[model samples]
Target: MSIFKKIKGTFQLLKTIDLDQLAKLNEKIDLSDAIKNLGELDERQLKGLMKMLTTKAKKGQHQLPPIDGDFYNLDLKLSKEDRDIQLQVRNFMEDEVKPLVNDHWNRAKFPFQIIEKFAKLNIAGIAYEGYGCANKSFLLEGIIAQELARVDVSISTFFGVHSGLAMGSIYLCGSEEQKQEWLPAMQRLEKIGAFGLTEPNVGSAVAGGMETTCKRIDGNWILNGQKKWIGNATFADVIIIWARDEDSNQVKGFLVRKENPGFKAEKMEDKMALRIVQNAIITLTNCSVPESDRLQNANSFKDTAKVLQMTRAGVAWQAVGCARGAYEAALKYTKKREQFGRPIASFQLIQNHLVEMVSNLTAMQTLCFRLSELQDQKLLTDEHASLAKVFCSMRTRDVVGRAREVMGGNGILLEYDVARFVADAEAIYSYEGTKEINSLIVGRAITGYSAFVN
Candidate 1:
């Protein structure tokens, strides 16, 4: 009689549920497990399950909007195809990259596993024409940079080296044969690439302090010196090494292969930030390359500056992504974290922090969008790029700092995500162009005085 009464109750509960309710429950739990164990449940257990399922259904129906950093709805401005690509990359980061990031970051290891899968996205050399590239708008390229950095700045820095510095060097300065040999493979991510411009002794003054010398003899160039902080150098298939011509006293670029006997790359250790990026110190001990491998069109520092002008904009976009990621994570944390029996997000001070973060993030996004537009129109200058890099990196530092502040002690934890952004922002702030260097570049343009050492 008792068993019969419980079965009747189960049947009555079933009548109140429909496929929609069951589908929602599937998202919250493994329904198949529930079904397999249903027969073993006592009357009390059956009643408890019914109540839990009903509560989940109510919560499902009231699902909140997804947390996004785009407070200004900038995504709506993208074309349908562009918007689709953005979402695809976002989903890949959220699903594939996000899960592996903290683990890899904690161990200070690069997740080489993602490279093949990331290649399938087909975004490398996206703005350049030919060479298996999409030849999309520069704006799309900036958007891709933003999307990648939002998840992990190390990943962003890795891609920037391969896609922007390495591939862009060949596209802008490589001979017809050089481009044919390298660009297609590089674009497919079949052959990873690195750029070696910053040497141990020459960071801010790489143009004039270039100690790496290349001497031409027997129609082969011999490279002799070292490069520091070269991203992706440890495992790259090729590296674009910039050196000074011994006789001409002019800066030149070389396509140095990893298989060369004299080329060696040692991984940099104990980095405080961007630990997942494989930065290396490269040594060229009489590294020899065929004359054909030289970047034929790279006659002077002016040509190399062309590549920097373009990639500097990408770095600005990356800063915005870093800020956005921190802002979104902090916002989500505050909303769910409770104090005094209510969410901290409802507190007045927490709201103020959130508001400040979003404002800076939105401003940075709009600035970069316009910078990309100028780049696409061929109206961008070195100063334009420098200004954006300066402003965005500075603003990003503020945004990430506040994000850490709002989270309190948990802000520094690696599991929380915001902590990584806070640390990585420091790297972005200094690289490409430091605040002092980039600001002087902009100031020189506006004031018509050369503040830089010549």
Candidate 2:
């Protein structure tokens, strides 16, 4: 072949070749001086070299579509009205709560100033029928929980304790007159509520082990005992205190108002997690609650479980939110933070971490969707709630850990948002039901064996 023809064929082949690979090939071939000389080439030649480098860089670039944790697009399935409500809550959290969370968490104080803004959402007693509730689907309730926890788990816990645990006690076990007395005002958030179930000695085992006692005397029941870890109890207008009836030996719930004598709720201090929740160590010595205020239908522990069963699903959704918050924060950090003149996200190993984190997050979102569906359908058993709680909470810990891992030192900083999730996830893992407790619940259901307390 002629020399000119041979050179023309070589240039044509090089033009078609992947420039990134060619750049690497050029590097290995010790073309440093030639590459340097090319930099001094004329504008047109320099432009051509720059174009080739850009093409090569683009080829070497990892194509990561925007990471959306909602793999199933469950929001699309919601009705327009429901979707609006969801966005309303989401906006409220993202705008109002997100900015204040780190400060409140660090100070270990509830952002009481936001309560008025929160009341405007009108979501208290959501999904409950009648008595001024929005009567939305249980799905909306789960979505609300997710939105709240996504920004601040402490706020979500406070909401759940009031709306789900306190009001739920009245809704599920209160008589018509009793419900008429409190549900409406509480629904409007004019009167905040708190649930007092966990005593210092009695945790989830309070079903039968409530050391707090109630004795019927004179037209009223006198409650005497200490209730610990009562969220919102410090400022709640009415706290639902569960106690054992001394005579019948059955547990009963009472609507103990804050003004009542002998009822004291001192804020539990120095909490390592969910600090903004305002959990109280309550003491009731001769706290007199009128018979009318007693949750009339709460004859025993079984009645209490009815409330827990409904709220347990919400807790699982909270776990999903906590995981998602951490995951997104970490994913963004990885893309922005650079090492060795490139984004850490450009590293294959970092990407592998992100993929795994998303995998777990997507699994959690999908699982919670079904969980809320089962709840809406009235088919959510203890085992179903337990399964989601176990899986989501456990997986949330993993997700948060990966988030922290990706952030390196910043992961441990409270201002980064991920550290709070990592700390809060620990509390959530134990509360509602510990990993072991929830696992045993599911285990018993599958194996037909009661493994608790034995």
Candidate 3:
């Protein structure tokens, strides 16, 4: 409280500021005169003055909020172990996958080099038991899907086709012998798999109007048809092909090897979205498969529906990731982008766009959370999965559109990252189940009426 102590404290505070800042302050006011007046002030006044000056000096040095997109703190709901796994997968995507995505996507090529590293994650078929899988909850599987698509949608699509559609078919419908034969290797990423269901002439209606046919000859089934838009078909070691039986007219599934004499997969080019995924037009000309390779449990369309129902939930999660990546990218861009000599994030209109994007992103995340919970509880119905696919895919389009809008011209450029998300969202909107088709599935459940045309 002595004059000497006050002067000493003032000097100490002055030392905390740099020379440049002191010069700037001197321009605004007389520094020597201010110090003379400060010596005349009471102890309390001097203390207050010192605090004010120190706070002002550190104004722009305050820490900014983290760049996380999980606005609702949903990760707190996960267990420590589950949370660790989530972080591990997130780190893998951000570290290994992100740097290479734009280049691979622009070139319309898959980075086959990363397959070995990706296999180290050991996440494939995580929800299923045995066969060297992790046997974790379906929620973890959904989270993995979200994390994968958060960095690159094409990689997520490739994973979904292999782990969800291909392995799921064998797990749910394959004979125990067949599962024992393929799943362990597939889980280790030693053998990649693909699903062939959508045909050249049929997509949503393939259940009843399938053109692919199989006949039993000399105890071997002969399959003849073409499957279009088959993800990973070009290099998959195995493909789960669905064909109609000539005798019973019921749909059946066969495990067709890529080395089969009559099987062919040609890469489809000129795609606008998910360019990193190797989608192929598969042709089967009397592809012969032994009876032992047939999926014993997949007897009708209902069996195939089971696989679709499961993967549809995964697709919904993918949409959430796509939207999340775009939102985060745009948010970061806004905070750093300046216009009129100030950050655009400081403007009212930019904040509004950011708020809207996060709102939709949060809603989609919560919805998918509950959807995965239902799957974990074994209560997920086709309608539940379909409704989620419809809602999330629709909302994803809105979130990505706003993301692109906020970035203006830069949003269209691939280097900005939002542009890739914008293009990929269109593919998510149409695939897995179109909005109209999924809505009808939900409508049928609610109204107790089948509106689907035969």
User: lDDT of each structure?
Assistant: 0.90, 0.86, 0.91
Measured with C-alpha atoms, the lDDT of residue 376 in candidate 2 is 89
Error in Å for residue 259 of model 2: 1.0
Model 1 residue 306 CA deviation in Å: 0.5
What lDDT would candidate 3 get against the real structure? 0.91
Displacement of the residue 158 alpha carbon in candidate 3, Å: 0.7
Q: Over the stretch 1-454, how does candidate 1's per-residue lDDT look in tens digits? A: 1433555666677668899997898999897786667765543345455556445555435434446688787877888688767766776787789999999998989999999999999999999999899999999999999999999999999999999999999999999999999999999999999999988877847777789999999999999999999999999999999999999999999999999979999999999899999999999999999999999999899999999998999999999999999998999999899999988988999999989999999999999999999999999999999999999999999999999999999999999999999999999999997999999999999999989777
**What lDDT score is found at residue 261 in candidate 3?**
83
The ten-residue window of minimal lDDT in model 1 covers 57-66
Query: How much is the lDDT of residue 37 in candidate 3?
Result: 83
TM-score (C-alpha) between model 1 and the true structure: 0.87
lDDT of 3 at 183: 99
Q: For residues 105-151, what per-residue lDDT tens digits would candidate 2 score against the true structure?
A: 99998898888899899999999999999898888999899889988
Poorest 10 consecutive residues by lDDT, candidate 3: 41-50
Model 2 steric clash pairs: none
Question: If scored against the real structure, what TM-score would every candidate get?
Answer: 0.87, 0.85, 0.87
Q: How far off is residue 91 in model 1, in Å?
A: 0.9
